[model samples]
Target: MTAKIEIYTWSNCPFCIRAKQLLRKKKVKFTEYGIDGDEMVRAIMAERANGRRSVPQIFINDVHIGGCDDIHNLEDQGQLDKLLFAHSGV
Candidate 1:
């Protein structure tokens, strides 16, 4: 089974671009929620991100994976791929 990836971002956020680039390089399909100037949507994203109001909040198979730097750190540690491919058959 393929992993379900989601990212919350603003249209012009640099970190958001970088994060999406990394995912594209890895060839992983992802859903993006671009909440630019939308306070209500941002609030929802923050709620999902454990109160983090930062753009580029990510989720892998419904698991919160944090922001761009966090995801890059996971990739550097050789852990992101494992998380990406883990299948619980849910």
Candidate 2:
């Protein structure tokens, strides 16, 4: 089965855009939360991010993958694909 993914972002955040681009390139479908000025949504995102308080926080299969740089780091290490297409083999 495909891994579930989610991302918290802002409307004009470059990091968010880049993160989406990478996921799209990988053909991974993810739910996005654009919390630009919404304090309520930011609060929730912060809680879920373990007090990270940063934009572009991501989650894979309910596991927090952190921000754009973190995901990019995973890709750099040649490991992001493993998480995106996890199945019986993984």
Candidate 3:
């Protein structure tokens, strides 16, 4: 039940780097959308993020998980693993 992970980011963003680092540390493969200077992509990401216009927006199994700090907080709370591994088996 490997959950599909996705992230939207701009190049040279530290939060994106940190987010990817966490995924690497967890040994997870994810799809990354680098939206450098692309307003349309950023707009879509913002809409998906509930108006969060920040880089490093993340999703797991289509569930919005937010940026690096949000992810770290979830991990600190011992819940990131659950999100990373959850699958509907569909």
Candidate achieving the largest lDDT: 1
lDDT of 3 by residue, 1-90 (tens): 678999998889998999899999988789999999999999999999999999899999898988999999999999988888766332
| Least well predicted 10-residue stretch by lDDT in candidate 1 | 81-90
Q: Give the clashing residue pairs of candidate 1, or none.
A: none
Give one digit per residue, the lDDT tens place, for model 2 in 1-90: 668999999988999999999999988789999898999999999999999888999999889999999999999999998998886365
True-structure Cα RMSD, model 3 = 2.4
1-90 per-residue lDDT for model 1 (tens digits): 658999999999999999999999988889999999999989999999999999899999888999999999999999988887777442
Ranking by lDDT: 1, 2, 3
**Candidate 2 lDDT (Cα, 0 to 1):** 0.91
Candidate 1 ranges beyond 4 A from true positions: 88-90
